[model samples]
Target chain A: MANSASGESIIRRFITIISAFDDKHTSMSVAELGRRTGLPVTTTYRLVDELLLERLLERDPKGNIQLGTRMWELASRGSKTLGLREAALPFMEDVQSVVQHSTTLGVLDSDEVLYIERLGSTSTIVDITKIAGRLPVHATSSGMVLLAHSPSAYQDMILSRPLTKYTETTLTDPAALRRHLAEIRQRGFAAMPGVIVPESSGIAVPVYGSDSTVVAALSVVVPRDEENTAARVPVLMTAARGISRALGWRGKLKGTLRQSH
Target chain B: MANSASGESIIRRFITIISAFDDKHTSMSVAELGRRTGLPVTTTYRLVDELLLERLLERDPKGNIQLGTRMWELASRGSKTLGLREAALPFMEDVQSVVQHSTTLGVLDSDEVLYIERLGSTSTIVDITKIAGRLPVHATSSGMVLLAHSPSAYQDMILSRPLTKYTETTLTDPAALRRHLAEIRQRGFAAMPGVIVPESSGIAVPVYGSDSTVVAALSVVVPRDEENTAARVPVLMTAARGISRALGWRGKLKGTLRQSH
Candidate 1:
């Protein structure tokens, strides 16, 4: 029998306390964590102290707990994200230099677009995402690129669920979303105007890896009035292919690159 | 009374297990972790499983455990390192472009060099000091700058003990190292030839934070030809000051900057 009721697995409680701080909330006090994890204040304090001692969580100047540098070191020292990020950096720089707007990197994390990297001019566009922040899978252009190429099960999971809309153009209806995803797949990129934000149009292309799997998405946010959506698509696709090639994706991308052989 | 032994502090054990993998070893098996952490096999397995469940540790293709991206996400999302690295990035890129060697950003971590960011040509260097990896305080140029600018008590503590020697040029004599520190303080940069490696030289300059405290060391590793030593010193100092200013260091740095404000 699993000892779910017993306080034996402090690790689960530890996770519970941390998982409480999602995109909406990043910093929380001890009492807040206790209430969120439903643990006693004393136990939360003890475990939090332990985590602080281990440098897994840090206390800010205001005494709020935040994730620590040690945790980042442990996670990034040997992660798939680092390899992908490293391979993508040069090409992303190329895209950012050319696009001269906002170039962002997003990967699917639990049915949402978890942005790993984003580069932008300070006055370019009203960006909605932050590094390591998440957005809905059906509302953002990068999300649509990933969703269109995702497995059928994942597609059904999102399509069957109630989709939240950010703006009037956001594809909240499951039928409309399915049609939009089809168009995205057909065009090999997603260009959604005023979907996530009113003044921004998002253009995104999927990046493949050595395994020929869509590993990440490269996206740009431009002014909604910009008529060069098709022009930006090739630039993004080229950057994505460059990143893919850097990651050992030797196979030629469908319309993005010229055949060498 | 301490009811739980420090050994049972699974969090501490988890840190120890992960920290065991350094520049030398990036992956480890359960058995190796047990040996390194001095935990039993079953305990190692259980703890590793817990870490895996939390996505703090990842399994490589060979079944060895390595650090995960979730660690980087948690560590970087709200940490000062991200800001520091972000601010240092453009200048670091500038330095990497000019130096074309091992240009790294290292911070003071318990008197040793804990490299936070490294950018260089992959084939330019023979050394493997990595991000999050530590080097001896006296054996590295960046380590020397950090140790020199550190509290006098830390210097006493380090010098009161044995000084390690990696190469014949390594400063093992405490009195000599003390002299070297004084010189570094006077010159505003530390340049040592063949200290870490026989055929290499490391030029480092201190990077100050908003509080005007030296918080990091920016260094470049070059082939120890003595011909490029003078040429590299100004470049390293310039990059260091550029990063320092980006970090909000308002103080003037001598010898590193050619322009006078």
Candidate 2:
């Protein structure tokens, strides 16, 4: 239980240190890490030393500290996300091959859509999704699919919050978003045209788990001009079903299939 | 700072708690976790509570704790492995497609081969490699390819170890392995027939980084009887080069190309 003078627990400090790194900042010196985390230099050095000793963090040839292979291994070895990602990968590849667009698998987390896997395309689509990147749940097709499938209370919690208007088509109004969510549920997919990026459109479908609950969103990002919803939706739906089956989903359950009063 | 009376550091205890959960044991109860980690019940509960509060551990509906999405997100967001894996994925897909077998990307970690990414096949080849799985360096084709390009001192250190004879073909003698490694270095690939599993063969090629040093091994596992090295090696080599280029490797440097005395 290492607590700083600021009354922050060691775990919080550890998270702060780790969170200072991202795709753009993969490695840095201890001084820079301290500056980024706003932790005292001594504390940063101490925590980093312990992490390095455990091989959770490694120093490069230049002595810049970075996350270690052991860190990724420890995080991945028992992660449920790994199971979902593995289940979705082959199917996502198939969709990518057929659609010739970026295929992504995302799950709703912490009120946002966190993309877990993304297969890029050589096409000139303006998709901004990256692995481990998060986007607002109200703006992305994957987010809409996940939001549509979420429990009503959770949906209300998100809808009641002030939403960012990323694009003209983004559903920011609670009543409008609620209606759109219902429509997405009824249609079995969400196809948003330039909801976040003006040049691209994302089409997504729900991937179910063994309990018949939506566990992820299988999506494709294509050019807005080519908004081929008719063609793309079927491919995503098929691939999502394949992934769901791989995740041990035995179709839909009869009890859940019954209409709510 | 929260070290138990046993004198183990808090970080070490955290690692012990995390290491207790793997692919086979993705989730467990607090009592079960205590048993698995061999930590005191109170310590386990305290750590688990802190981890849960940080969203580093999440409880399922049944109250079994599993690795959290936040943990995976944090580990992945700034990891150098992500860049390497992403660079290798498209090429690995190509190798997996053409070879119709399991294609893997592995790196040298802790004197063993740690597989980072694996594209599985529908083929009947017995490939024990899994993402985040580790295998003996002397017994895997990926390991051999990586070892061949490693510094001479590392090669000496590994060859000095008591190597396990996984199969009749696995080299246990240091001299024999040294010769084989030289041949692999000269040939630009490693093809091991039934070195680990009796029914399969693995062929691997090295992937380079921006610094022109060997960073990873790209491999495919095929049926032993169908070990078509001639055709498969070219495919693997081609994909490895593509991945290397994607990782910013500008071919081999002139100084490195000079023969080492």
Please name the candidate that would achieve the greatest TM-score relative to the true structure.
2
Instruction: Assess chain B of each prediction and give its TM-score.
Output: 0.86, 0.94
Most DockQ-accurate candidate: 2
i-RMS for every candidate (Å) is 3.2, 0.6
Per-residue accuracy of model 2 over B1-261 as CA lDDT, tens digit each: 444688888888888988987999999999999998889998899999999999999999889999999999999999999999999999999988898879999999989999999998545579999899999999999999999999999998998989999888888999999999988888788889999989999999899999989999999999899935657887887798899999999976443233211
What are the chain A TM-scores for all the models, listed individually?
Answer: 0.88, 0.95
TM-score of 1: 0.84
Residue pairs in candidate 2 whose N, alpha carbon or C atoms collide under 3 angstroms: A1-B1, A1-B2, A2-B1
Q: TM-score (chain B) for model 2?
A: 0.94
Error of 2 at B61 (Å): 1.6
DockQ per candidate, 2 decimals: 0.41, 0.84
Candidate 1's C-alpha runs over 4 A off are A1-8, A16-39, A58-66, A121-123, A253-261, B1-6, B16-68, B233-238, B252-261
RMSD (CA, Å), each prediction? 4.1, 3.1
Per-residue alpha-carbon lDDT of candidate 1 for residues B11-104, written as tens digits (9 for 90 to 100): 6676677777654566788899889878778878888898888777778768998776566566567566767777787677778778887788
Model 2, CA-based lDDT? 0.89
Candidate 2 at residue B46, lDDT? 95
